[model samples]
Target chain A: MDRLKSRHLQIAMFLLPALLFYAVLLVYPVLRTFFLSLHEWNGFAGSKVEYVAFDNFKLVFEDEIFWKSLKNVMVVMLLSIAIQIPAGLFLALLLNGKWKGIRFFKAAFFMPVIMSATSISLLWKFILYPGDGLVDGLLMKMGLEDSIRAWLADPSINLYTVILICCWQGLGVVMIIFLSGLVSIPDAIKEAALIDGANRRQRLWFVTLPLIREAVAINVILLVIGTLKIFDNIYVLTDGGPNHATDVLGTFLYKEAFRNNRFGMASAIAVVMFLLGFVLTLVANRAMRRESLDG
Target chain B: MTNAKVLRSSFMLVILAILITLTACGGNKGNNSSSSASSPAASSASSEAASEAPKEKVTLRIASAYTPDHTFGPAIAQIIDEFTKQHPEVTVEKEFLPVAELDKKLTADRAANNLPEIFIIFPGAGTADYVKEKKIIDLSEYLNADPDWKDGFISGALDNLKFEGFPGIYAAPIGAYSTGFYYNKELFQQAGVEPPKTWDDLLAVIGKLNAAKITPMAIGASESWRSEHLFTALFYKWNGAEKAKGILSRALPYSSPEVIEPLNKMVQLVEAGAFSKNYIANNYAAEIADFNNGKAAMRYSGSWTVGESTGPNSPAGFGDKVGFFPFPYFADKEEHKDSWMGGVSDSFAVSSRAEGHQKDMAIELVKTLTSTASSKLITEMAHDLTAVKADVDPAKSGKLIAEVSKAMSTGKEFSGDISAFEPYKPANTKLYDLTQAVLLKGITPEKAAKQLDDEVAKSK
Candidate 1:
């Protein structure tokens, strides 16, 4: 009993330092944000935190811009799940083979993943500048001048353009993850499928895909989290404007906290975002688990 | 063992560990402060505290958005460096952030109560909010005691730096900017249009430019300030000084025709293809590029761009092609024809948190930063009007500054930026966002007015 108690103390000693940092950094902030959300404070300390219970949440509920931002976030999430996952998987499959120049191709594909989102977004902004930008310039060169439109200016389609850019930037990370998962699957499984008279397509469909189901799930989760947390690129590209048409939850909260000086409303939005990410990830994990069990 | 026994033991151990860490750190703090072998800052502080020290040394941590490349930063730095040279005991540390990121950074700093003693202050809602929270120390007392300092400022220059609904100088201003239209003379000449003599004449010029297939005006609505500058120009032009002030003070409704009429004119400009195809995508830089590259005929920006347009920064002959025009009014009916929107571009202030030596050091920094020599450096190097008098030479400061100086001197009315409207920043943000929505959402002038009115009502 003395030895067991000593070991338990040793365990506590090992864990305490890390736990202290975690509690101070993460847990403290989460609790503080919840506390701040309940009061009307303009981000200044000790300066009149008017205790307007649930007023911030109520304000967000009535705000048209907030609803619009929520809708935009939903659209981005849907697009990432449906488009990014498949595109990444397809690229991963194509690049998994030991081709003569596969290394060069992989390097090219993963380059954007290493580049900063802000720099990439700014680069793309100039490339898509309406009259003289590369996109419009190429169209004019090909005598498709009629096809030229203000890609980033049209509010109806600007969100989709930014989403496409995001997918382009993020696809490499998903591809690299899927590639690792593909490589991890035993070669014997593919050989066995071939020996059983399965065609190449059939072998891929039956063996390669099922073996990397975990990769698909992980990629989807990452894509979802990234989509929800999307701010830097969209902010650089459009800043939730030509009038809040491209607004997402992150930028919306940013505007509230910094621009409007409404820290309470921003915290409320942040809490809502956390809840969203929690619920969605939980649902996704459950669905993936149940599906894997069935398969 | 039972789970309860294990949990209790672990909790006890955790508390024990925390106590040890705290006691250890607390002991280190005392040791670190008392010894001369720690951080440079601590050593300086120790030296300052010494009673027999002949001179004291201190450092001021400044947070500024004035990057070295920006027009103001180098001149300001030169001024400060000169001060440091004269007063060898003082040290300055500056952190430069771009203007876009500065506000959010400063907001975080404010919340943490860690704002530097002397930092750049933008005289708008940010300054007002800081003043309201009592975070900024009133400089009036200091200024009053020093008549040379108080009298050195340009006539009425410090007026807008005061807090709304009070009589206190909240900021010490550095440079002033004037807002007006900058037209490409070559394009205007190509389109056979002179500077518009009336509101109708301006519309005719837009039509002519559209017909010529040259983008008539460049606007960067993505940055909402461009739209507000448009609003300021048109509103003040259409309805002279009194009505404009009335609208700003909320004595007259924002939905009043005097305001809505100018908004309608903006919509007309948009419908006439007065702006480039992707004007909404272009930010200030892109807008400037389009105008400089001769793709756009006209651009609205502050007079500070005089340096960039004329200097080696831009292509040669760019300066000669550019000319300024105050926003046009109804020639036959308008009063206050010389009125225009202009204000102090940047200001500085001392923090309320400053204590003892820090307070004196902060005041001294502000005085040195805005002294006549610094003001002269600002005018000659930055090509913007100084808040204090500076002997600007025509050969050095160039023709654009000379022209702007003449225009400013003749102008009878000058108002602050759109930020001066609505004390609460969120209301100002709403106004900017609604202006964007109106232009992009296909909302009519009346509908836009209604939305703006609703926002103002909610703001109350």
Candidate 2:
């Protein structure tokens, strides 16, 4: 019993520092945020704060702009999931093959992921400038002047432009992850499929894809979370402008808490965002688990 | 094995205790001076003489919402340098931020009670709120002791600096700005039209410019605030001061016909091809570029644009051609053409939480920066209109600045923008959105007014 107590004490001592840091930084703020969400405070003015439990959440639910922001987030998430996965998989397959200058190709594909998001967003903003921007200039040179339009200004297209930028920046990470997973697949499996007269597409679909399901799942989950919390790109790009056309939960929370000084409302929005993210990830995990079980 | 485990556990516990003690000691060291100096009465008394202490060095942190190289930042820096040179015991450290990030930083700072000794404040109704909350130190005592300092500012500029229902000054004005229509002189000449003196004439010029294949007005509606300014300018002329004041003060519903009329007129102008194609997508900076590059004939902006338009790196062929016109009013009998949209000042207030010599140094710096000599230097450097009446060279004043000054001086009542007077956050953002929606065609003027009513109701 004395030995066991000493062992437990050693483990506790080892864990103490990390636990203390977490309590001070993360756990405390989260509890404070939960408390803040229940009261109305301008965040600055020492105004009388009334506790209206759950009212802020009700207001958020009823706000049309909040719903629009959620919809915009969903559209961005779907686009990233739909386009990034298959494109990343294809690139991963190509990079995994024995080819000349494969190292150069890998570096080139991974370049965007290494660039800062602010720089990338600003670069895209410059490229999409209406008349003299690179995209417009190139289109005009190609006798496509009629096609030139303000890419970031148009409400119909601004969200899509941001999504395209996001996918472009994120493609490198997804590709690298899939490439590692493909490399880990037993060469014997591919060879066996090939020996059975499987073509390129057949071998990829039957052997490589099934084997890399774990990587695919990881990639999807990461992309989903990343897309949901996307702030910098949207903030730098459109600022949720042209009539709040590009607002997302992150930007909305930022505006409310910082710009509007409604800390309670902002915290409520944050709580909702956290809940949504947690619930969606759980649902996705459950679905994936069921798929694995069935397979 | 048990003995070894016991020894390891004892050693680990010792290390943990050491770490906790070190952290505690470090925290105590950090707080020792601050907590002692933080009592309001103590700081208030010490603020005056803290600079005289030769042995104690006090560093004052100033937060500014201007880029370091911008006119405002450098002006403050120059003043701080002069102050520190005289009083070597006091040092000022500045943290420069872009305008977009200022409110966010300020909000976080306020919550943490870590606001800078001196920070920028908007002299709107929100100043009243800050005063009520006692977040900012009252400047009445400081200003009253130095009566000559009051003479340095432009007349009536201090009106906005007064807190609601309070008899004393709560903040100090750093500079002033006014909004008007800036037209390209060359473009106006090329189009064979004079500057429009009335709303009808302006519309006629728009029609002519459209026929000539020129985008009459270049605007950035995407930023929302810039677009909102145009609506405010129109509202000022359309509804007159009394009605506008009533609507802005929430004494009248935004959906009242008085408020909706001007919005509808703005919509009509939109339908009549008054603005550039794809104007809804343009940002304020981009729109300025369009006007400067001769792609668009005119832009509605504040005097701040003068610097960018006439600066050394100004776009090709923009020099000597920019001209100003007070935003025109419709010739209808009811409209007040003499009324203009103008504000007294943009200011900085010392935070109440600042202690020791920091508060004193901050107030001194603000006073020095706003002195006539410094204001002249900054105005000339920034190519901005000077709020204080000074002997600026007519040639140096730039025709646009001269014209705006003339307009403001001659105008009947220089009423503030309703949006400018609103409190920070929800009210201000709602106004910004309403203006943007009008410009973006997301809502008609009637609907825009309705949206304002909805926002007001929700806010209340």
Candidate 3:
């Protein structure tokens, strides 16, 4: 027993540095943020800090801009899942086989995942620039000027434009996830399915897809969390403007905290964002687990 | 294993833990100080404990929002270098961040109580918070120490830096900027129009420009400050500055017709197609490019454009063809005819966190930064106005800069930026959003005004 205690103490000594770093950097800030959410503070040294429990959350709830940002993020999350998954799967399947220049094609598909979001947003902004930008210029050249609209200016379609750009950026990672899943499938399983008289569609539905359910679960959960916290692209592209038609929770919280100096309100929004991502992820994990058990 | 071996290993582990804890503590102390030797306050205390050492080398850190290529950036750098040359014992560490990035960084630093020893205090609302919190020390005593430096500043230039109810001088002005319409003279002539002097004249010019197939104005609503500047010009032109202060004090509601009228005019401009096609999507760079490229007839911007429009940096090669005019006023409201939205918008302040010798060094840095010699460099090299009176020869400066300089001096009254709408910044943000929404026709002027009023009320 004494030897075991000494070994345990030695192990803890090894883990102490990491634990200290984690507690100071991560745990402390999170708890501090939670504490800040319950007070009214302008985030200034020696400034008045008033404790008004849940008032910040109440204010956030009553804010129309907050609701609008929430709705915009929801749209991005739903559309990212709808578009990125099937498209990523299709691309992954097409590129999965051993073919000529398959590596090059795979690299091309995954390039944007490694590129900076700010640069990508800037490139897209230049392309979608109104009147003289590439898209409008191309439309004019093709005599399709009638269909051209303010891509990043119009409140009606600005959010959708940003969402599409986000989808473009996020598609690479999803494709890579699905590609890895496809590669891990055994040759024997596919051969067995084929021998059992399974057609291409039948094999995909019965054998291939069932095997990649784990990747899909991961992709879904990641999309949910990633889309919910989306900021840089929207910030660089529209900055939650054209009258804030494109604000997400991240940008809204950031503006509240940094721009407005309302740390309390921003902290509350952050807490809500965390709780939301947590609940949705748990639900996705449970659903995936249930499906796997049923299969 | 023997017990002696286990005991020796345990002793080694204990020493390791001690080392880790010591390193962590040391790291924290290092981060809080400009140098590894000591924190600024701690050093100040120690130095006070001893007699002043004249030969001691000191490091002063300064944070500012000027890019190297910015109009003021080169001039500011040259001046700081000159100061360091004069006093070899002083070492200046300069941090340059873009304006938006600097604002956020300063906010975070303020919260952590880790602001730099010396930093630029943005004018008006930007200085108010620092003053209220006493994050920045009062500069009156420092200014009084040298009458020549105090007297060098242009009259009323320091007025805006002094916040109401806070008595002492908290900042010294460095740069003065004014907001107005910058027109392409060639385009206006091509369109058979003159520089607008009144509201009716502006409308007629817009009509003629539209008929000439020229975009009348280039507005970038994506940057809300562009629209906010326009709104400020309209409000101050119609109602003047006194009433603006009244509105801020809640003596007048934003929904009042005097305030809503500016929104109505903004909506009218939108309805009349006075701005470039899809102007809402354009950024400040793109908007200015439109005007400079002669694609648009006019733009509403600050005097900073004068430097860029004339110097080698001028992208469009328009040269002297760029002209300036104040925002047109209502023909009947002649009281505010001479008024312009203008003031010293950037200044220098020493952080209160710097103590003893460091505090004195920071004050000396501020004085050096705002001295007459520095102002001349800024005016000549940057072609921008300084708070200090500098003799700018017309031969060396462009016609545009000369005109702007004349307007800065001759204007009867000046008002603050759109940031002055409320002490609560979120309400000011809401005002910016509302102005953009009105420009985009997303919301009516009346509704936008009512919404702005409601936002301000909520902040209170």
Local accuracy of candidate 1 as per-residue lDDT tens digits, A27-124: 76799799978888777655577888998898888888889999999999999778888899999999998889999989899999899999999999
Report the lDDT tens digits of candidate 2 across residue range B1-460.
4766766766667667656866886587567435634667777677556666754776777777656545455555666678889878777777778765776677787766577878878776755766776678778788878877777778888777886576778777766778888888888887888888888888899988888888898887777767667777787788776676575467778777766777777787788898877787677677878888998898888777777687654775575788888888788833487777777656778877766666676787777766787777667666776445455665654666666777767677666666764543475787788777876777777767776676667775
Among residues 3 or more apart in sequence or in different chains, the pairs in candidate 1 whose N, CA or C atoms overlap within 3 Å are none
TM-score of 2: 0.91
Tens digits of per-residue lDDT, candidate 1, B342-409, equal 86767887876655455667788899778887788777787667788776676777788787777777
Residue-wise C-alpha lDDT for candidate 2, range A16-115, written one tens digit per residue: 7776677667876798799989988777533467798998898788777899999999999999999999999989988998989999999999999999
The list of candidate 2 runs beyond 4 A from truth reads A1-11, A45-49, B1-41, B48-56, B65-80, B315-317, B333-335
lDDT of 2: 0.77
Task: Assess each model's interface with DockQ, reporting 2 decimals per model.
Answer: 0.48, 0.46, 0.45
Candidate 1, residue B65: lDDT = 78
> Could you tell which candidate, 2 or 3, scores higher by lDDT?
3
**How would the candidate models be sorted by lDDT, starting from the highest?**
3, 1, 2
Fnat, one value per model: 0.55, 0.48, 0.57
Evaluation by lDDT, superior candidate among 1 and 2: 1
Question: What's the lDDT for residue A40 in model 1?
Answer: 85
Best by DockQ: 1
